[model samples]
Target: MGISRKKIYEEIADLIMQDIKDGVLNPGDQLPSITRMAEHYQVSSASIREALNTLSVMDVIEVKHGQGSYIKERMPLGFEHEFQIITRKDIENLLDLRKIIEVGCVELACSHADEEDLGRMQDALGKMRTAVMNNELGEQADYEFHMAIAQSTGNQMLVDLLGDVSEKMLETMKETRRIWLYEEKKSIQKIFDEHQAIYRAIAEKDSGNATGAMMRHLEEVATVLLKQHK
Candidate 1:
């Protein structure tokens, strides 16, 4: 039997999700127009619109009346409940998935990133440093650093997905950090050092080192979370 309209919409959603998973559709990048998408998917424009609406409610994308549909910034970590029912297990899964995806993204970014992209990453890192030194909210800065790397991959979907994932993780980390209070200053310093390592690996165009650095950072984060739960 032929596919139904509902099935078509579902497929469209899956396509968008896959793009995010593969790092093709980046955050902040405008989605192709309904007409364009319809032509690409060989579906009715109405179906495409419906799929886009669903993504919008999920905070996966934002449709600004006139400007067009763009990916939304990542939601702050603890704010997942505001949009969806994200459980602790979900958070753990997200962390694992992020570890795998981010490692690849860093490796790709090291090879693909240009001077302008590197400059942007350095700028984000500088913000993180300032935030840590001033005892301000560094979560955003940290988020930016990762997002910048995702951007460097020249993949819009990957950038958007990572931004969304990181945003939620950052919120979770903020709450966890507050509860643990394990040498706040020292912990912050460790984070800075870890970020520096990732940055250096990317700067040197060493994909292997970048992946390794990312893994170490994620491992440290996971270790902390595990200890807190125990």
Candidate 2:
């Protein structure tokens, strides 16, 4: 079942609270930039804004003008533990499902994508490059570029399926990114290269290359999470 929009906002709020309770975030600590939070939460800026606002209304955080949102000295009531929603097995399942859908979608996109689709993907890649330059994880741009490939497939069912599971996928993506970027100490250029390969293959209308690229990306994701699970 698809998650409701309101529930997504609440979930984002809970993720932040979990970080706080774990002592990963401290009072007076400025939260990650809104863009970073939106990527990590797999929500839009508006949704993140609403989530932040919800925290503010509950007096859990303070949003100061001319500055970003800050953790407040006082936490809302009953935030003693993390609100975990899924297990490692669940994340592995999602990556497997994504591989099945996305690999096929890329094959279709190779034949169906037009110049406009290519342009959208190019723009997303540009954003990714900029994110890397700024020492950001570029998760949102990475999602959008893959989404552009799905969009190019011109199959509403494929598109709908991806959208339905995207929320769950976003959560796993955060974990995967954290491992590769921070825990594993991997170079960010590897991520950029993988994405660039996918884009170039699609741009060249090469289904074989696109399928292989998609598989490589998804396989790495699944492998990382599975390793973490073990």
Candidate 3:
């Protein structure tokens, strides 16, 4: 029964990919409503959602919390192999890398961030607030906030490095947020607050506080995510 259910969702994912290839769904196109797709595919909503999640993790679709999922600008190369091999350990390693990179980033930002940098981070916060109100994941805004911190460091090399792996970072955020929201039953407001704390510490130019906040935020997410695998 489990094997059959998994096959169904994978078939649905393949069908959606075919639609994209056929130009039935174009880049930046919002997918049909889940309910609509469920009825059309004669599958449960859970199965439809699983298919969408699979595509989203594969970088084939972008899932917004309140907004519907949309086709990505480009499909990832070698996604099938990635879908097969992605594991909890991969997520754990990613979270560890973030702790190493981002905690130091916020500390540097406390020293170098100008008003313009703060403005960008604040702008991201505002967008996150709107997303929370709308009951969305706010993943894009969350990504922007972290990028803004990297930018605030005035380190072009670091910015470029993060940009190169931006796709993976965004995917990690989506996965952890899903775990936090759906699996852990966390409130969106609480999640937003973690980012807010990091922002506040940087804005205040307190390196000690900024690093602590960033570390805590990443660690909290890591604990929640890793716990699930156990």
Question: Which candidate ranks first by lDDT, i.e. highest?
Answer: 3
* Candidate 1 local lDDT, 130-186, one digit each (tens): 867864447677778888899999999888787667656776555444322322434
lDDT of 2 by residue, 37-57 (tens): 878766787878977876775
Model 1: residues with Cα > 4 Å off, grouped in runs: 1-86, 176-181
C-alpha lDDT of candidate 1 relative to the true structure: 0.73
TM-score of each: 0.59, 0.65, 0.64
TM-score winner: 2
Error of 3 at 186 (Å): 2.2
Where's the lowest-lDDT run of ten residues in candidate 3? 77-86
Against the true structure, candidate 2 reaches a TM-score of 0.65
Q: Residue 129 of candidate 1: its Cα lDDT?
A: 87
Residue 207 lDDT in candidate 1: 91
- lDDT of predicted model 2: 0.77
Clashes of 1: 10
Report model 1's TM-score to 2 decimal places.
0.59
Q: Which pairs of residues collide in model 1?
A: 23-158, 24-156, 24-157, 25-156, 25-157, 26-156, 26-157, 27-160, 77-168, 77-171
